[model samples]
Target: MFSYCADPSVLDGWWWFSCFLTSATHLDFYRAFGAVIALLLVTAPAALAMGMAGAMMLRSQIRPLSMLGRFYVNIVRGVPDIVFFLFVPIALGQGIEYLLHLVNCPDWDQPVRQGNDFLVCRDAKMPPVDAPAWVRNLYAFAMAILAFALVFGAFVANTLHGAMQAVPHAQIETAESYGMTRKQAFRRIVLPQMWLVALPGLSNIWQILIKATPLLFLLGIQDVVYWARELGAQKTSLYSYPHPDWRMWYFSILLVFYLLLTWASERGFSWLTRRLSHGQATAEGERLRRATA
Candidate 1:
């Protein structure tokens, strides 16, 4: 920005616009996009790991594990995603702080749950009572990631469990005839095929996750959507750089952002499907084999 930007009142046209857009708040708006990216990068793998665990439990020979898996996958999938979004972070946060209170304040003579309040020692607050802004934001971001993982992992587990069951009985029997145990057969054969079979469903979930990133605003994160709405609202004559409502423009930019994300995800999934389809017996793989011959 030019030194002329120091007197924004006198400036107009390009000079005024330059300083306005590059303001501290606008810079935060720019950084909020990274917050969304960070959420996705961290959450996808976490959700997948949870899903894999649930799916393995679902397919476990032990009756208790299988029943527990069924209960988890079915119950979570049945619940509204908004309920978990609203509930999980607060519940986990309180639960964690309660444990910390028990360990740190054992000599204290106060009830943790008097009336409706969930009280804990000052030391029990997440990120600590005196922690800085970034630390608090990071703590909230981690909670959001956990909630997303819990909600989405159920769908992923169902997808993977179905895919695992879809693996042919004949292949399992063949592996058994070759003196391989069920675990060995599953690890060597079923697991790889499950990924291929589950790819489409997983891709769908990926796209849904991309769209759902906007919901970060609901969880109190200053995500792109939050920034867009904030910075795009009307700035009146009282403000240094007054403007009419620009929310339509801001949201239009978000529209393009989401569309591009969906496009890239589709291309990536298509490539992955092709890569995993090679030399396999699935329809896509068989088609590839025929094409090469």
Candidate 2:
């Protein structure tokens, strides 16, 4: 970006470094870091909401709801995460298109599955063939968000389910003794208490979710990992900013990025844990009480 960067061939020392760092490719790499953070910010809460729903279903009195919850938790937890990462987006996309096709092209008699190809009418094509690049990117991102939420949601459900159970039966009973319904008892007592129990597991899940953001590259999102490899690859004299193999350096940067992310996450969760522990009967709460006194 500097005026001196106009001719990279004549640049040396810090000037060379500055130009290299500010190159178009390297700038794209920096933006990819934002992509990683965006995925985490969007996916974490969505996955938590999905998990909360699944956990509620797991605890439901209705047989079918309970069974469905069990199925979701069991199947998702049992399957390899990479398998779902690969399969769910394609399946969900096709499913959306198929539903749209039924509505938009009702009279078209051609089957959707014709041997090897899954075809949909032009009207039912997602984002449409003529859609802008941003539209396609948005669609892909939405799919990635769903995939992350679904996979992580299952793990969250399992964690929350156990946390829900860990709440003392007496606490619910006490709420009932105060003329509260099962729902009120759960909302007022069980749910709040469950967080204290669930925090550690959820914290771990958050770490895993951070680590998993790199998989966005596999799903065709040009995430930080993709940019790292692209920008760090060896370049020849033909290129304006030539460099030797720098994959290790690029990945080292990624490693530091992840380490910082994890470290910050841990500190945040620790603060959250302390906040949640306040006025509770847990050891953390007691320690806080002692410290404050």
Candidate 3:
């Protein structure tokens, strides 16, 4: 923020633009980029771990565990993603509050949900109403992260399950012939091959996850999209900094940001694929070997 921004009325041309870009709201917009990145950084691994667990469950000998895995994976397949995103945070929030209410407000007279409102005791409110701004933001962000994880985890589960299945029986048998136990062979033989096979699907999931970051706006976090819409709208003379509608400009920057993000992600995945393929006996490995030779 600049001193020139104090009198937004007299500001004009490039000087006005400099102060405009440096304004408080624009600073928030800049920081929102970090929020999106943080969400991705946290959500990606969480989803992968959940997916791995779900995949193993899908393969479990125990009927109930397998059934649970089936439900986990199929829920994403059955429900539209946007619908799932909308539902998860609200459901999880209510569920948490409900548990809290039971513990903290058992003696309270009114129903927890009265008509259209969810009325939890002050102590039971998630983060409590009086908590600082950052705490509330962090809680909402955490909820969004979990919501994204649940949806993407299901897709990743299916991908991993198929990849594990695609590991040849011959490899497992050979590992057993070498006096390895089933678990040992699974770790030493099956797991490595599974990742090699799974890379393509996982790569796709990462791309989709990137595109899905915009949905953070819907989850109540002031994400990049939310900031863009707010800052890009026409500012009337009544506002400190008056400007014409610049949403197109704002969105164009977002477009560039996403394009670059996707480009970088694809390059990273391609490199990882090559790294995974280098020593393997797969066709891609052979191709790499021939190219190197």
TM-score of each: 0.94, 0.97, 0.95
Off by more than 4 A, model 1: 1-4, 237-240
- Whole-model lDDT, model 3: 0.92
TM-score of the candidate numbered 2? 0.97
lDDT of each structure? 0.89, 0.94, 0.92
Global CA lDDT computed for model 2: 0.94
Query: Whole-model lDDT for model 1 versus the true structure?
Result: 0.89
**Which candidate has the top score in TM-score?**
2
How does residue 71 of candidate 2 score in lDDT?
99
Candidates arranged by TM-score, highest first: 2, 3, 1
Clashes of 2: 0
Instruction: Say which prediction, candidate 2 or candidate 3, comes out ahead on lDDT.
Output: 2
Top of the candidates by lDDT: 2
List the lowest-lDDT window of 10 residues for candidate 3: 235-244
